[model samples]
Target: MGRMTDQPARWTQATVYPDMWVDPDDDPRNSEGRAPDGELATLADFLANYRMTLRMKCEGLDAEQLARRSAPPSTMSLLGLVRHLAEAERDWRRWISDGDPLPKLYGARDADFDGAVAEPGEIEAAYEALAREQAATDAALAAHPDLGERLGRDGIAVRELLVHRIEEYARHCGHADLLRERIDGRVGQ
Candidate 1:
C-alpha cells in the first residue's frame, strides 16, 4: 500500500473509516435510505449515524495505510480503531444480553488493539467482523424497542446503552479527524 504523501490539492471526502465500516453522511440505520415504518426511531438514529461517520473516516485505505499511526507513541491507527470498535460492540452486546458467557472476541480487556497488524487479510477480516457484530447489536437493540427496558449487568436501561454507543462513536470520530489529517491532511465531514 502506498503511504499518503504530498497532500492532494482536492481532498475527497471520506465516507468510511479506514476499515470500510460505514459512511458518515448517510443514516446509520438504513444508510441506503430512511428507516422503514414502525422502526424504533429515537436517539439510536444519532448513534447509528455517528458510527457511520467513524467508519467513513477510515475508508479507502489498504492494510498498511490503515495501520499507519497518526503520530509517534500514539499506537492509534485506523485499523486499530476498527478492531477497538468491534470489541466494544461485542462487549456492549454482552452487557445487554445478560452475560451470555460467549468467549471474548479479542480476549480480555486492552487486548483489542494489542496485536493489530497491517496485513491485508487481517484488515479485510477485521472490517467484515465489525460489520457482523454491528448488525447483530442493531438487531438486539431492535428486538426490544422499549427504551425503558432494563438491560446491562448494572440494570442500565436500553436508552442508556444507545446513548453510550453514540458517545463512543462521537469520541472516536474526533480521534479519526486528527488521524485522517495526519494521514493526508484531509478534514471535515
Candidate 2:
C-alpha cells in the first residue's frame, strides 16, 4: 500500500492497454470500423470509446499500483487520471446545466491530485464516480438534440462541449500510455 507521503523509488513499468483495444497502427478514432446501420454512430461514440480506452489502460491494477507516480514532476498515475477525469466531467456537467451550483467533486482546485493517493477501494470508487458522471453527461447531451442549443455562461454550444469532451479524453488516453509504460515494461496500445 502507498501511504500519502511514502514515495516509491522505482515504480513498476508496464503497459496494460493492449493493441486489441486500439488498432495496432491506426489512430483510435479511426481504428474501429463504422456501423452499417449507423445506429452506433455519433460524436458521442468517439468520446465514449476514448474514455473506455483510458479505463482499459488502468485495468487489473491494485489501488496502490494505480496510484503509483510512475513519472516524476508529473504527479500523474492511472489513479490520478481516473480521479481527474471524474472531477472534469462533473465540472463540465455543472457548467452546461444551470442550477447545478454544485461544489467541485474532488474538493478545491488542487484536491484532484491530493486525494489521488492509494487506499483500498480508492481506485474502484474513482472509476465508478467517473462512469456515473460520464453517464449523466451523456444523458444531458441526449436530452438536448440540437447541437446549437447554447448552454453555459460563455454560450458554449452543446456540440462544442461534446467535441471538447472527446478531445480531453483522447489527450488523456495518450498520457495513460506513458504512465502505464512507466509503471511496467509492457507496451503496445
Candidate 3:
C-alpha cells in the first residue's frame, strides 16, 4: 500500500475539536490571562506556548512517525523540526553568550533536519539536545533582562532576538501541525 493507504479511512476518525490534537480544557498551551503586562513577558509567553505546541504535536508518535516526511519533494518531518529548533535554540544561546559564542550543535547547514533519521538513539538525542538548548537559551535570555540592551558581537537588541526566536518557533510549529495531521489525521491548535 502507498502512503494514502497508511492513513485512516476518514481524517475525522483521529480528530477531536474538529481535528484538534487535544481538547482546549486539557491543553497545556491555554492560558487564562491577557498577554502579560509588558513586551518581554508577552514575547516570552508566545515563545513558550509555541514550544509547548511543538512538543504536543510530536506527542504519541513513534520514531518512524516522527521522522516520516510529509510528502515527496519535501524533507520536512516532526523529528526534523525538533532537531532544527534545537539548533535554533543553541544559536540563540551562542548569540547571547557573554564570551565566545558556542559552536553549532549540528556543525553543518541543514544538518539539524537532514540528519533527523528515525533511529532509537537519534530520537532520544534530538529531544535531549532540544531540551538542553532551550534551557540554556532561556538562562542566557534571563541574564540579560533589558530587552533594549544589545548583546553579542553583532550588538543585536535582546528584543529583536526574542522576536526572532518566536518567529522561528511559530513558523516551525505551523509546519509541525501539518506534518502531524498528515501522519494520522489528527489536527488542532
Could you tell me which 10 consecutive residues in candidate 2 have the lowest summed lDDT?
6-15
Worst 10-residue lDDT window for candidate 3 reads 8-17
- Residue-wise C-alpha lDDT for candidate 2, range 1-189, written one tens digit per residue: 855733323332332434333444444444556533432247767776788788778877777778888656777788888888888888787768767566777888657776888886776788789989888877877777788789877778888888888898889888887777666543535
44 Cα displacement, candidate 1 (Å): 2.6
Model 3: residue 33 alpha-carbon error in angstroms:
3.7
What is the lDDT for 25 in model 2? 45
Across 1-189, the per-residue lDDT of candidate 1 in tens digits comes to 979867643254445653333344643445555654542464766776777777767777677778887666677888888888888887788878765655667776656566568898888888897898899888888887888889767787888888888888888888887777677666645
- Most accurate candidate by TM-score: 3
What candidate 1 gets wrong by more than 4 Å, as runs, is: 1-40
Candidate 3: RMSD to truth? 3.0
lDDT of 3 by residue, 50-88 (tens): 999899888889999999987877878999999999888
Q: Estimate candidate 1's alpha-carbon lDDT, on a 0 to 1 scale.
A: 0.74
* C-alpha TM-scores of all predictions: 0.77, 0.78, 0.88
lDDT of each: 0.74, 0.73, 0.84
RMSD of candidate 2 to true structure, Å: 6.6
RMSD in Å for all candidates: 6.1, 6.6, 3.0
